[model samples]
Target: MYQPDVFAFPEEGQSGPSLLPPPGVLSLWRVDVARHCGQAARVAPGILDAGELDRAAHLVVDADRECYVASHVALRILLGARLGVAPGAVPLTREPCPSCGGPHGRPATGGGVHFSLSHTRGVALLAFADVPVGVDVELLPKTGVVSEIAGQLHPAESRELAELPEELRPAAFGRVWTRKEAYLKGEGIGLADGLAAEHVGTGPRPGPGPAGWTITDVRVPTGYAAAVAVRAAGQPAARDGDRRR
Candidate 1:
């Protein structure tokens, strides 16, 4: 049972909190987009890079754009503080595609830290670790849709969902979905690898992750589900003295 250092956004009009997770300690930060909506325009311009700003501008829906800007700004602020660089100046790169070698997979930084971001509805989640890491958060689907998409999960997960009482199935299915996604993203591959190919079963706790990876369920606000995955055992954990606010 890995416990992540969790941070929440401060009250309105206050500067965002600084974060410096202990080395080897995975940090999970959650932001409520609605709480930051009023300050998005003022804060986002200062934190987001040019590419991120441009991308946010092209989002057709107002809520989607707000979430995009809030999530990216939070990522930049947190990572920048840790890296000792200005938020907008933090360099973010993508890993080459495993199949085609195209530069369009997981987002990365040159400083050796790994991170992943996920957002839905009005909430965003960011995770940071010393080793490669992926985090995913999803808004629980409606009960009717649970059965509709059950087949997309691994056989074991699907069977488990079938056995669950109807009211409990959506949340159970969400756990499986997020666990699978976090593992895939940590591997630098998105759903392109196929969710059905892996067998992370449905339960309050995560089942075995892909070999060499560790998966853990994340505590999230009601109506949302989240998870994080990191390389099981590899490089030494980052040292506490290495981080600066």
Candidate 2:
């Protein structure tokens, strides 16, 4: 695990809601910083701290395990500081599940917090909060893969991407892919759940009711597109596209 640059929470006493949830309501003022790195050396020791990563050795059995350990360590430290708990006592675990698999394969802790993680290249992203959350990022391929995968995305999403100008196809496809992925993650049923058929257009669109999901476009570096999906109660003011930064 690596340390991230921490910042003071905003004076407003409201921390931003991640796309996924139990929606940490304790205090919005806590800032959990993150970084994208190709190797562990890039992480700052001050941010990661020793105690936070004590369990990291136990988590590195595979590539996914490595990513999860690093990501969890980063999140626990940030969230622990926010919640006024000792970073090591924050209780980060592998998210136990004996049967569930596919997109919703996340591990859960006892508290209301829920999270989902995804990584591509060397970057990993963790989405955590009080609601069920799922997040994904993809490094865009300049080929016609997006167009070819049109049938893979929801019908409306496919149409939207098709309508995009030639140069914008990549971006449009990335957006829809991330959104659909995030939605599926929130549902606890990843891509194997047939995304094109279920939850399509079931989002914030009127007459569609609330898809019981929220999506935020994540602004990762160029060539990589990402989105976060969170399930929330009522309609948080920050609904679909609300977290599109």
Candidate 3:
């Protein structure tokens, strides 16, 4: 599937987003949004666009607003490093929806690159690829959440999740949900396409993705789950600078 090595986001003044990926190499990066929240006062500021700044300002709660700022700042930093433009100048936009041709699709950039971003309260994940890609990170949900949502998945996936012990269902549900979301993000259809439409499994690993796409679970900190999806048609070439955290 060409999932590149996962990297801890580079700190201020440090090298870069996994040493700034070489041309055509798929790259994934993770950061502690909560941790970055503590530094938002200095790290945010001019890195974000006006829209992002306004969005962050509207998140009244301190943690929520800071997390929003931190994640977006980290996104701009990495995208800037990748596209060789200033962090504030990365030309970000959404694509046309694959399902309806609406202008509300996955996040994208003007430079010839494909990327995806996903973040929860404490964690943020970013993916860059030469091919269409989507990535997601989510905290483990409550068992009640699992019970409520598992049935909305594909029949086979619902059955797999149902067979699990209640204590284990949350992580399994996390896997299933992240994989499902990642796949959809890559397809530029989002959840409006219906969760039951695809059968990303609830097991430790993901099942086969839609034709022409690849999905897989990604390792993250305890209590969270992450995944990435990429078009399999034209996987990027491997590079020697690819790294791991």
lDDT of each: 0.78, 0.52, 0.76
Measured by lDDT, the strongest candidate is 1
**Could you give candidate 1's per-residue lDDT for residues 1-245 as a string of tens digits?**
34444444434322445647588888888877888765765777667778888999999998899899878877877787677777777899988765457998789986667899998878888998888888999999888898899988777788999999899998998899999898878877687656777777788888775667788988788898889988765733222232111
Per-residue CA lDDT of candidate 2, range 62-179, in tens? 5544554445444654555445564445554444321353322455555656666666654556666666677777777574886678777556766766676778777666766776
lDDT of 3 at 37: 67
Residue 91 error for model 3, in Å? 1.0
Cα RMSD for candidates in order: 6.7, 9.0, 6.7
TM-score per model over all chains: 0.87, 0.59, 0.87
Model 1 bad stretches (over 4 Å): 1-19, 235-245
State the displacement of the C-alpha of residue 95, model 1, in Å, after optimal TM-score superposition.
Answer: 0.7
Rank order (by TM-score, best first): 1, 3, 2
In terms of TM-score, how similar is model 3 to the real structure? 0.87
For each predicted model, how many residue pairs clash, with residues at least 3 apart or on different chains?
1, 17, 0
**How high a TM-score does candidate 1 get?**
0.87
Candidate 3 clash pair list = none
